[model samples]
Target: MSKSSIYLPAGFRFAGVTCGIKASGKPDVSLIVSDRPLVAAGVYTTNQIVAAPVVLCRSRTPSSTVRAVVTNSGNANACTGSQGDADAKAMCAHVASLVGCDETDVLVMSTGVIGKLLPMEKVKSGIEHAVAELADREEAFFAAAEAIRTTDKDRKTESRELELGGESIRIAAMAKGAGMIAPNMATMLSVICTDASIEPKEANAMLRRVARVSYNRVSVDGHTSTNDTLLLLASGTGTPLQGDSLCLFEQELTELAIQLAKQLVEDGEGATHVMQIRVTGATNDASAETIAKTVAASPLVKTAITGGDPNWGRMVSAAGYAGEPIEPAKVSLRVCEELIYENGTPLKFDAASLSATMKEHPQVNLDLCVGGGNGEAVYWSSDLTTDYVRFNSEYTT
Candidate 1:
C-alpha cells in the first residue's frame, strides 16, 4: 500500500502533538474525533492495579456511541491514588469540551511511566493544540501513531479495504507498544476505526473475539501494562455489514489486528528476533494456548533464541510446567522445520547448521506437538537480549 493509503474511515479526524511530558520533547498526546457519534467498543488490561484511564474507559463499556478518544504517553497516570482518576477525567472533559460532546462520550488512555501524576498544565496545552490541528488525513494519522509511543522504535499502523454491501468499507488502526506488553484482553494502546456501520453489541463481540487471538496471544516481557487499551470505532458512513459481509469484516479485523500485534513484537524493546510458538495436538484450544504462552514467556527460551542457541530442553521444560496433561512419550518438537525431538528422545541434529539458520533468519518458528487431539494455537514473542536488560535498567532515568 502507498504511504497515503492508510486513511481513517470517513467522519473521523486525528491529531498528535507534543506536551512537555517527555524529556525527549516528542509528541506525547493524541486525539481521535468522529464528526458524529460513532459506535465504540473496547478491551482493556486485566491488571489488578489498573491505570486511571483504564478504569474510566471500562465504566463506559457498552456505550452505544462515543465521539472522541484522548490519549497520552510519557505518563501512565497509574497508581497515583485519587489524583490519577481526577487527571483522567480531566483529560476526557477537556477533549469533550473541545469536540462539543459530553465527557461520557470521550474515552481516555495513558501510557509511559507509572505511579506519577500527570502534568495537567502541559496536557491542557497539548490537547488544545491537537484539537486545533485535527484533520482527516494521513499526516494526522501518522502523528497520532507517533504520539502514543514510549519505547517503541517506530509508529505501527495497518489498513484494510474491501467491498461490502455494495460499498467500499475501510478499516485503519494504529498501535504503540514495545515493552510491558503481555495482555489478558488487550495490548498497549491501539485505536481502530472503520467506516462500515455495526451495532455496539456486535462490535463489542467482534472486538473481544479478534483481540483474544491477536493481542492476548503475544508477549514482550511477560509484564502486562496498567494502560493496555484497544478501542474500535465505527463511523457508520457506509452500509452496515450483515451475514457474510459481517463475517468478512470480522476476518479483515482479525488480519489487521494480527499484523499490528506482530509489528509490536518486531519492535519489542531491544529485540533482535521474533519467535513464533505453535502448539498442536493438545486436548483443547485452552491447553494449547497455555503451553504456547508458557514457552513464549520463558526467559531461558527467549535468551537462548537471542544467542542463536537451539536449546530444545528449555522448550520442553516450559511445556511441562504449563499445567497441561502431556504424554511425554508422544511429544514432538521442531525449530524452523528441523525436528529435533520426537518419540521421547532428542534426535541428533547439526547444531552448526541450526545456529546458522537462526543467525540468518529474523523469525524463528518453534512447533510442539503433544499427542494427537487436533487442538492448536500460535503465539508470537521476541527474544530476550542483554540490550533489553540494559534499555530497561536505564529506562526511568
Candidate 2:
C-alpha cells in the first residue's frame, strides 16, 4: 500500500532496521534524530504497568529538552523486571552514541506484545545502520512510522499547512495503535514534528491541551495498553513563532492527531466499521462528554450498534453509569434525529430505517440531555464482533 506522508521539519531525520527481534523479516527498530536540541513534549498512557521506555522517556521529556527518539516494535519491553529498565537504557545509550548525542537527549519508545525481551545485540546493530543512513530525512519519517506498528493494517499519517509571522509553518504527524485501545478511549502512539519556533514550556502545554481535546476523546474496544506515548518536537527552523500562530499550530496538531487516533480505532483488529459517537445537551460540555463516553464504552451498547439493533435503553443505561449526576427522567437520546428516547422513555421511531442507515454511513450520533449545560463531544470507536474476540485471544500466538 502506498502511504501519504507528513511534511517533516528541516533538522529531523529517521531510519529503521531489522533487529531479529520479531520473527518476521520486517524492520523492528527505528530511530529519529534532530541535528539540534528541539522543543519536545510527550503524553503517556495512564496504565500503571507502563513499559520501560515509556518510564524512561517520561523522565527525560518533561524537561522539554530532547534531541532524538529511539523506538522498537515486536517487543513491548514491559514486565521484565530490572532487566527491562537496563535494556531500555542500553538501547538509548547505543542510539545516543551512534548519533553522537547525549544519553539524556534521547527519548525511547517500545511497542508490540507485552512481557517480551528485546534482542539487544540485534537492536544495537540496527541502530548503527540507521545512524549511518541519517542523510535522508523523508525516509526517516516513513521508517519511524513503520517501525512502531503492531497489528495496524496500514500506516496512519496527517499534515497541515499554517501561516505564522509571514512564514509558512508545516506540522506533520504519524501514529499506530489498532488494538489494546481505550485510554479514556485511546491507546496509541503518535509523533508530531514541525518547523515552527516555540518554547519547550509552550510546546509542552500545547500538546497536553491538544491531547485532552483530541486523542483522549476516541475509544476502541475500551482496552488500554501499557505502552502508549505521544511525542511532539518543534524544530524552529522556519520562523520565530508565538501568539496566535502557536494556537493555530496547536489546533492543526490536534486535528492531525485526531485523524490518526480515529484511524487506529477504525482499523483496529477485526474492526469492520468506524462509528462517531457525538453527545450533546447536558448541564455542561464536560457532563456531555462524560455521558458520551459512558455510552461509547458500554459493551452492550457497542454490540447493539454492531448488530444494527439501535438499542436506546443500552445507550441511556450507559449514561446513567457515567459517574456524573444525570437524571434519566430529564435525559433524551437520538440516533441521527430519530429521537430514540425522550424524558427517560423510549421514543417511537423508525428503528428499521436507522439501522439501515447505520450500515451505510461511518457516523453515529447519540445525544444526551440532562439540563441546559449544552456540552458536546465526539468519540471515534468501533463495534465489538466475534472476530474481535478471536483476534485478541490469539494475538501473541
Candidate 3:
C-alpha cells in the first residue's frame, strides 16, 4: 500500500529518527504520543527472559491514562541486569517529562541485539529529537514503522476505519519483525491505536483475544524472542461503541492484526514461501494448535517447502509426533489443495504436477484432518531457505 493512503487516527502523533544507535545509521528511535491521556493495554513476551522495556511496560499497562510510547531499535537492552531496567525507566521518565505526563504514563519497547547496553547518550538525544519532530501525519506513521524494523526488509502496517454510533472510528497499527517468531509470539513489536472510546478492561480483553489468534499463530524458526510486545491504545476521540458496533470494532482489529502478522511472515529473513497450515478434527483447539505448530516448526517440513518438494510423509510424521492423540486411519493430508494421503494410505496422484504447483504459489497450504471432531486451528510459517541460514549466521558480525 502507498504511504500516502495510510490513515492516521485522531489524537496521536508519531516520529522516527536516527540516533547513531545502529551501525547502518538507520532510524533507530520511534515515539507514539497522544494529545490526551488514553486507555492502554498490552500483551508481552511469554519468554521468562524478557527485556527491560518489556518488564517496565508490562507493570504499567491495562491503564486508563497512558500518554505515550518511547522505543529504540538496534539495542534490545535485554540480559543487561539492573542497569537495563534503570535505562528503561529513564526512557519513560524522559518521554513523560516531554509529553507532560507522569513517568508511569509512558510505555517503552526495544529490539535488536540481546545482552547489549544501550548508548544512553544517543538514546536520550534520539528521544528528544523524536518528540520535537512528532506529527499526526501519514509520513510520520510511516517513519515510525520503518524505524522499528531490524531484519525486516519492508515495513509492516495497516489501518481500518468503521462507523460507530454515526461517527467514524479509525484503527491504525504498525509492526516490525522478520525472524525469531513462534507460537508465543516472537521478537515482534506492534502498536495499535484507535480513535474509538473504550474502557481499559475492554481494551485489555480485546488485545489479548486478538493476539491469541493473530501474533501467537505465526512462526518463522520457532524461536521466541525476549522483546515481543503488542500494545493497544484507545484515544476515545470517537463515540462509544456498543453491542454490534463493539463486536465490529473487535473484528476489524483482528483482521488488521492478522494482516500485520502475515506481513511479518512474508518478510521473514530470505523467506521465499509462506506455509499456511490448517489442522482440523483434533480433540480440542489446544491439540489442534500443537499439531499445526509441530508441523510448522519441523525443519524437514520447512525444507521441503523451500525446495518445492511434495514430501507429504515429512508433514504426516511431524503431526504424528506432535503428542496429540490421532488415529492414522482417520487422518488425511493435502498440499496446495491436492490430496496426497487419505485414511492411513498414500493416494495416487501426479507428484510432478503437485510439485510444480507448490513452486508456482507463494503461499503453500497444508490441510490435515485427524478425525471428525469439532476442533481446528490455523498457523502461518515461512519456509526455511539457505539464505535464511546465511543471513542469521552473520547477523551480529
TM-score for each predicted model, relative to the true structure = 0.98, 0.94, 0.98
RMSD of each: 1.2, 2.1, 1.1
lDDT of 2 at 72: 86
Model 2 alpha-carbon drift over 4 Å, by segment: 1-5, 135-137, 237-240
Instruction: Give one digit per residue, the lDDT tens place, for model 3 in 35-150.
Output: 89899999999998999999998899899899999889999999999999999999999998888999999999999999999999999999999999999999899899889989
Question: How badly does each model clash, as a count of residue pairs?
Answer: 0, 7, 0
Task: State the C-alpha lDDT per candidate.
Answer: 0.91, 0.78, 0.92
By lDDT, is 1 or 2 better? Answer: 1
Task: Identify the runs in model 3 with alpha carbons over 4 angstroms from their true place.
Answer: 1-4, 237-239
State the lDDT of candidate 2 residue by residue for 209-239, as single tens digits: 8888778887777877888899888877444
Ranking under TM-score, best-scoring first? 3, 1, 2
Candidate 1 TM-score versus the reference: 0.98
